[model samples]
Target: MNTSLKTILTASVASLFPLGAAQASEPATSGQPDTVLIQAKKISAPNVDGTSQAAALSASSDSAALLRDVPGVSLYGAGGVSSLPAIHGLADDRLRTQVDGMNLISACANHMNPPLSYIDPSHIGSIQVLNGIGPVSNGGDSIGGTIRVNSPDPEFAMAGEMLRKGQAGAFYRSNGHAHGVNLNATHASDAWSINYAGSLSEAGNIVAASPFKVVSQGNGGKPGLAGDVIGSSAYKSENQSLQMAIRNASQLLELKLGLQNIPYQGFPNQRMDMTGNRSEQLNLRYKGDYAWGQLEARLYHEHTRHSMNFGDDKQFWYGNAPGMPMDTEGKNSGTLLRAGLPLSERDQLNLGIEYQRYRMNDWWSASGTGMMMAPGTFVNIADGQRDRFGMFVEWEANWNPNWFSQIGLRAERVSMNSGPVAGYNAMAYGNPASPLSVPGAFNAANRQRADHNLDFTAVARYTPDSSFSIDGGYAMKTRSPNLYERYTWATSNTMVMNMNNWYGDGNGYAGNLNLKPEIAHTLSATFDWHSANPDQWQFKIAPYYTDVHDYIDAVPCSAASKICPGRKDGFLNLSLSNQNARLYGMDVSASALLLSTEKYGQFLGNAVLNFLHARNKDTGSGLYNIMPLNAKLSLTQHLGHWNTTAEIQMAAAKTDISAVRREMTTPGYTLLNLRSSYTWKQWRFDAGIDNLFNRFYRNPLGGAYLGQGATMGQGVPSGIVVPGMGRSLYAGMQLKF
Candidate 1:
């Protein structure tokens, strides 16, 4: 440990106890507690409000990064904007993410446009994370948790009066020379209101400063030289949205339109980078209050166009390789309707129906001569479609003040189909008589597939006293495979296999048509302890376990199938299959008020710990890309209009990894972070320094390093792990009027 870092930590901890006794008798804050609670599933759920949102926005522009502080949540970084979030060790498409009640699907084969990337943090008004257990009304196509993000609520003025308000904010960071700006404006009258929000952000290449030695055999043997600046990691993007609302005596209607454009963005983990992306979305909703009950209806549609290719640093690796550019287009639309009714004085019933349809096409254009047997060849998924219809019913009961319970059930029907796929010059590729050329057999074998899925959930909470509570939940969840998992036809050519690179494992993959839907059974429990005083101390611990039947995994392809391409290296060409798996984890969090006084202000301390264990039931192998045991601790101080925070993040060495996937181990390390903010009138200022000591380390779940610098002939180790970001200083300011 660094001496300066030790001194700062000791001084901060030593100064708190002396004032603890004196402040215990002092009064608390002047207003209500700074916690907002929402009633959902017959329980009180905490809401991430404006203050927390502001702090998150000031830290990073990526929306997924904001969830890192949440218990039972972890991140798998692939690029500056394409980081995937995981819950209980399930990640990527396994989790359901909804923005403003719209289900947005990724348009790129490499998953460059995740659901969270659709909205900027500046436009988010509230976020709710339903940890492993969620209501059936949200969605049924995923076994993991659900994340719901909502835009700001519309404002209304008094009768015969009008109101206008606006806000502007900007932030800049030194690590990648990243900068961004956001603006929002609104006007409201008694019956109608309109609002607009927009943002723009850009960043240069990131520099890795970790000094850890490289242990992988693939990267060139330059031991400590793998942490140099990563190439093709720059990006720029813009987003805008408009919302209109109208209200009568007992009914409200709203319409929203959103647009996004990204000229270029690079991925350090995948084989290709995003050259361009453009998207548009429209959403409409109606809410009414009637004597019978409450009614709500919603409809939404989204379209996206995405393109990918090699970046400047990697273009030479191919040296004029033809058919270099790949493109994808996607359209997603859905409708939802729900009603709430009171069955009795102590019971309530809620019913809802949802429908979603997704269409996608992936194709690559050939460039240069002598590369393709024909003039133009497109070797990717074509005209792929997946549709889902779901209905759910939930019952909530308040048996007594000490007991609250909820039970829900959902049914979903999923159907998938795709057009015929073809490979270039069938005869030249050694499959002249086979269906590899036109893929006619492939189309006929998997033309249309359908699955009927069901889900059930039961949860209860017991409060023995005002300061103690216990919650327990059990759920049975199911998920159908995505389009790419079932429609990507196999090919002997490795180039075609490499096109389906979503996991960043540096291996080729093909889809399987005979895959079964994954089913998961989960049980979770939480224990909470709090002081009678609201501002004193609180602690919570949650433990969860999940058993997955037919879990998706990669398996080796047989030579007779002609689907596996022979690679000179030891890596194997694999395809998707179903296997059994089990996962268990625990999340612990605690917060305490160390001091509170009229003269000295307030001081608080917080800590969080997360652990996970996942394994394949049949093979007894650890799951790939599982997060290591990690913990975070922070101290916060507030005086007058100024606030400051000091944080320490630590992770244990990862020794349990998937041997089949050739996963590497990472050493444990610690990082320090600092932040401060000040407020005056309608303006606020924020500043922060991340990786304060500039300690160098690699994240266990950051994925493998696939940049050109790590290539076999590039001078650096070919299999070096991706390193974490270097030290960074950032500042921001916001004004509201």
Candidate 2:
């Protein structure tokens, strides 16, 4: 689908939202130390302080919330700690998200744990989000853009001195009885540094403003969920990490070890909950500065062991089947080598080489202690493997002070293969097509596939003066289908398809073997108007349009995939397909210093408005899970060591929906959030209230409500949208020692 310039201009009234701007910078070849900011492009975090108190004090435990203020970014509602971030209407595997320089893949079928979930906010030193026009050397195999979250660097003491520092913080939120604690400690000398960071967070079911749906009664005398409560919304997660750094005058060596344990996490939209998930990671990196260029090399390995079953909110007994349990195991390892070479005084070149290998296994165990789901083990995915090799070269030129340009090209080769799979039994499971037979067909079909993708980006930044600037560019990006999008078999089995859904839309999805890589062409520009001084006043607007080919969507499945037909207002069973899509949007953001006086205090105001339109050109239907028109406005006051902010958030009613997915619509609503913080030397305290009025509203990206009941076989009714939080009070305190 090629969206014309006329079409984009036609939708200008309600189309675009711009947040902020990024300045293209020439890469440093020499005269500087090698840092994580060695790429051809430079992108800053949301604020001066990365993962600031505002994020830690918020009621939500999801660290992805830190990107809420960034332009062209939104989140898909998931578990308490795992929210999938969407960039310019593209999400999940479509975005390249890196954590501590490692490209992590979601191991679970439901995608309950995304990359951001691995690192707690307290451990973050910086977060940067780049839209589609980012330089090719930033990353590859992605269309939406790139997100980088780097851990804090080692802080060494002065010459001949020792460094010792530690900080502890804790917070509590009322809505879901959510609470958490975080600790950070560092010990370093002038030459070496050792640091450890840890956090623990837990929450119960969240309470809605009002009763929204009637849940089913569980089997074996288990009562149904309460009306005012959103079930399967609870979670508990613990993370610990250790870092050691060794540095010389021109080189730095770092080693990081990370461990995560998510004992349990409930998903209100998915049929199953995460009962247990554990992951371990080891990362090694070295950065050096040479006469001609700066080079950085990193190698990392991660492994995940995950398990899922019915949580307390859902029914456990199903006649002979006591509980359905699913397990997934995955291993990921990758290497990244990047270098910046100076070509001349005004030009720099960045070259990158990358390799990644991932292996995964998904299987289901018989239920009821091997009585109910008899036959044998159901092998959903056996020995799945995906490997990627990529290379890119980018050039950034500083054309005087008034104009700058960046151009780059990238190429990637991705290969995937999966072993044979089998169902629980060889007999037909009451399906017209005989669900058990599909496994044989799937196993016999060609399971190995590969794709070659090429990407290009051209960006230009113009600043006529200090008060005004414009940044615009064109980007062509490509991404291959993920494992879940290409390897999920068994189209005839509704039970199996239902378990593969990651959108939480209450629909069953079966993967298709014949899928193509998605290619996207994007045109975007950001215009800025502001005062010359720092923090006085600034306004930015960005408008963007993207045309995507071979977009992964869905189509009606064979009749055999039906889930107990004749149900009223039910969900659909569909198979994945490649389609065409077009997305256009704009973002507007402004900040101004309202007042400043020594006798009083300083007051600042900030506001942002976003609008997006995405449609499947092949089907002429709106895309799924895209956020609607929304605005965020805030006023902040600073007096002495105290800071406070009052924020108002508004979202227009989401009426445009994906019919193929039976997407739900949400009503427009407004929310008020208030927070205040006080700092006293080594002590800091924060307090906030979210949804101050106890307003009732639905989450635009919440998908459907499958939080409770017999979700396995369409036992739960549809049409109920997930509700947003209401009237949550929170307080946090931190102390340094």
Candidate 3:
């Protein structure tokens, strides 16, 4: 159960068995810059000079699931498909996740299309995660971290025709009744070739704690959210994607298109059922090698439309009590472009610019008694034609091969102009002008505004030789306040109380339209080492820290405050103007070849461990969502065309870092996963099981809700604090013609 015991057992036992070893071998060629490439049989990514950056790379059963394995990254899920990954306790618009150079920002107040949501994990070739202020070329909005997902590249281009000339492959995997499929095709003809990929998946209700009990009413007893839990809730989702690529030795071009549709019925989260929530994305890119250096260009666009409706289902309860009916629709869209060109041999540069827009319009049709409260509300809160333009540049210089440095800068301007958000007060409470008091009334106003910010980053890399290297970086960036934080006008729902204050509920709430952007400064360092013949041993370690200023926080306000509803203790437009925070962590990765032979194939053993800590500078309290110390042991074996692998991952018990704000605590847990694959002639097949033991445990977020013991399954809480998936199995295959 302890880290030392687990490590000793994994190394001593797993290393002795070929089935528990990785198939590590020398690279086919030398002189390549990536001399210490960490090529585990199951996952592939550029090893920063023999240093393995832990990234959860796999056919994502769900995009957010992939980030769970990455150190310092955690997802806030309401126990289902609507999960959003948070980094270093930062999420929503705070972190940036890009795919093939394209950015995917979310538009939902509840955060539906978080960066990862648009990506189909199975379609990704590799993933790279920079814990904090990684590469400026990756772009800067990461006060927490940044993740880059790369699509599978052409394989035949490097190995040649004998290995795989005209090969086509397909894969299918199912877990707990949710099934996924992938189809891939590749062709090579001496120089010019093409690769294509497509994937689709569907899932059903997730099972959670069942028949749990609690006191229904609050008096002298613990105030619980639900009196007694019924049958556990279920979640369902479907996603699909397509990618086409044209590449040669000197040039490459790729076109990617994806569509995802999720409609949940009887699931947790909202009172109204998610009717038709769909997302569409299109991306294109071109890269080539030039005599001077290299040049690459990219363009991308995405659209998301979400709708909600409440029918005869009694599940549509209001304020934790049976009440009104509701319905609405929302949408968001954007476009971006980036280009990189080397200016000189010792200096390389990248430039990027982008434009984006967002809008939301919703109509509600409430009937019967609830209709009388707020009839036919045409609730429209749109940032009509909101615009943003940004320009960024990165320069890399080599002070010989032993030392190099890179610096990046970005400037952006944003403008928002739309009508004021209008909705019924919903609660009659005390005001005669409240939306509930005056039914079918339009109370919110129209609006418009503009804002701009500048971002900066710099990094230095030192490599004394091919076997060892070190890197350090620093950055400064800013993020504008979101529209909802500034202009939302609605009476607070007394049922959903804020844990921070205990009474900031239905009394009355107001918005602040004058909030400024949050700013951040970060510093990071990494060290890497590898033997000349790494087929034997290698080691890598990275430590990082970040300091953020003007950190945003929400608090309750008294009705006497400057903002409206000053006399009531509720969620008014209260903000922390000058706040700061810091986060630090270390990640270590090491591998040793246990056995290697041409006849028996190769066997290698590897492990990765990480520890992270973060705190609010203002309160010296623990930051939210920081992952606990954890480690993973993996073994891969190869026998000609047959291969097998197994891994054991462990998480240490966690103590709350964010004090006062109760965080969910998890007990140390160990999990075992097994995988095997075979190749016959021109065809290949793979199969694996995740969480083989079907263990059950709740994450920090899920635990936080249980602690609240209030109206939990509402807009903010929404079962997001429940445990994740249990034991699951999957299999896939590919063929060559």
Candidate 4:
């Protein structure tokens, strides 16, 4: 490694340590440098201050929390630190998450660790969410949008002269017992910089609602919402990140690597005796100034290994879940490269190429691992893999100083290899009476393959002046059948119902080798107006419509018992499907500096409103689990050494739940949060209370899953509801030398 690179890595590593203990005596003049503000795209937003002033307050926030304030954005908060950002009524695989221009897919099926889990909040230098009008350099097929998180990268004029030498800092935070410590640090030199961040959170029964109450027909057919088993329900999750960058007169290069591991004793759905996951990622990039304009290039690779098991004690309780008996493993790998160049004063170009692969395996233990079935009874229902490669290019030319048009095209090639892997299908036959009832042995020779995919997009923007602009675009996108959607033949416990459900098979769920990718054509427009002087005020409004063909939905199949005569209750099953969908929605957001310190008391106020309306013609039901109209308001007071903030959030009632499933309506509810900090020059103390009111209400989607017995004669309903959290408190302190 080059000495500069070594120095870079070292600085980032040091940031991982607890540096608050070290003091230089005098207060550091500069805390963090100001970043070049990118136009706040609806897709990505980065919060610089400790509080989420410009965004909606979130219970669980990752690097992408900055965009919560953007119009038409909602987050699925699974825990206190894990969340998935949704945009324009789209989320999950539709939205892409990038760290330093790299993608790190979480390994868990429940999505415990989303894109934001890879970095520590303290180490983030800046974040940008390209909610709408996504830059072509980010590639295509992102219906929701993309989020970008950049580390500390700065340039010095003298090259070797240090107008101000960037220094390193670190801090650690720990909660009560079972709570693990989190550490992070960073250092910046005149020409380059490095940073490291990590966290270890081990907690038992995350403090639940006080005097908790249970509904008679709550989750898992359990009597009452059982008080957490305290020590029995425990979890441990950790993340470590290392990043280094070199900056010269006109060039910049960076490399990043990261790893994370998580293990838990019990989760809500699963009978959970134990479950764990491991993930890794690496990325590299180079950027330099060219005579015509600027040039940027980047490459990345990522892999994730996920293994989970339900202890024997409870393994038999939940029927036919995939990877049951504690030995299921899933893997994913991908690589991507992107480049951009400014062709001329009035034109620019961005292009990218990317590849991705995914695989899953199910094996039984050799020893008597508590299974009634024979040992070593391994079955490979998902002997499937997909290789997807895509290249996209965009050209931008200004018709006038204030008006410009952008056109983009993307071509993709997707090759799939799917079928039984020799002994894979035959083994499942042993379970003649179980849901693992394979129709018949499939020959490895019966494998199938498919190829060819292309997408297109065109956009135009007109800016009459610095204060007003409007933009819109048209795009066509497609999605192929995933491994689980096509080749899965075994029972799984990870779907809407916690049963040994088959994704698709000869039964109600049939695989269509001839299935075509879902195609969508979309169009949208945005209007923005802003004023920076005097009291700051900015506002943006967007409207969009999309029509999709061959859209897939997991509709009910034939009776599960009909396929497998020996099976008990009809097992849950779905097949390769298609439908037609048309959607339209609007997003509006605005922010203003209600008060300025120079003219009035040291106080600030901000508020945001987010709304969405979606429909599914196939089901004639509103998009499943779509959040209704919601809004958040916050106020902050700043004094010499103290800053205090309070926030209120409101969620509107929602009547949209998939039919076969009775939609549980969520009455409107309100929540309050408070936080404050005292800064004494080099050191700062922080504290906050979440859900200060201890209000009790369940999220519209909480446990809103199809129950295993919904198809049985049992009185159980189609969807189950999980309650939200009660009041909670947290505090931390930071120091700078």
Each model's lDDT comes to 0.75, 0.81, 0.52, 0.52
lDDT of 2: 0.81
Model 4 lDDT at residue 274: 40
- Candidate 1, residues 1-737, lDDT tens digits: the string is 34465455334533443232111111111111111112355542221111242555667888777677777788887767668888878988788888899987888878889988888878777666775567787757999877776778777789999979888889998988999999888899999999999999899877777543343332223322233666557788898999999999899999999999988888877667888889999999999999989999999999999998776444333434432688899999999999999889889999999999999999877655544424466657889999999999999998999898889999999999888766555543333245435365675564698999999989888876666667878889999999888877756566667668688766677887878899999888877656566456666678899999999887666522435657755344677788999999888876678877899878877777989999988778898888899998888877888778888999999888876666778899899999888778877788999999988888788666766543322243335567788898999887887
- The CA lDDT at 28 in model 1 is 18
Candidate 3 structure quality by residue, lDDT tens digits, 498-559: 21121111122233455567788877666655555545565666676667787765433332
* Greater-TM-score candidate between 2 and 4: 2
Model 2 off-target regions past 4 Å?
Answer: 1-55, 215-224, 369-372, 429-436, 558-569
Model 2: per-residue Cα lDDT over 603-647, one tens digit each:
777777888999999889999999999998888777887788888
Task: Show where candidate 1 strays beyond 4 Å.
Answer: 1-41, 44-53, 211-227, 316-319, 372-374, 428-438, 559-562, 569-571, 709-717
Worst 10 residues of 2 by lDDT: 24-33
Ten residues in a row with the worst lDDT in model 3? 496-505
> What does the lDDT read for residue 51 in candidate 2?
19
Model 1 lDDT on a 0 to 1 scale: 0.75
| Residues 647-668 of candidate 4: C-alpha lDDT, one tens digit per residue | 7878887776544323456767
Q: Estimate the TM-score of every prediction.
A: 0.91, 0.92, 0.75, 0.78
> In model 1, how many backbone clashes occur?
8
Looking at model 1, the pairs that clash are 210-696, 218-718, 219-717, 219-718, 219-719, 220-716, 220-717, 220-718
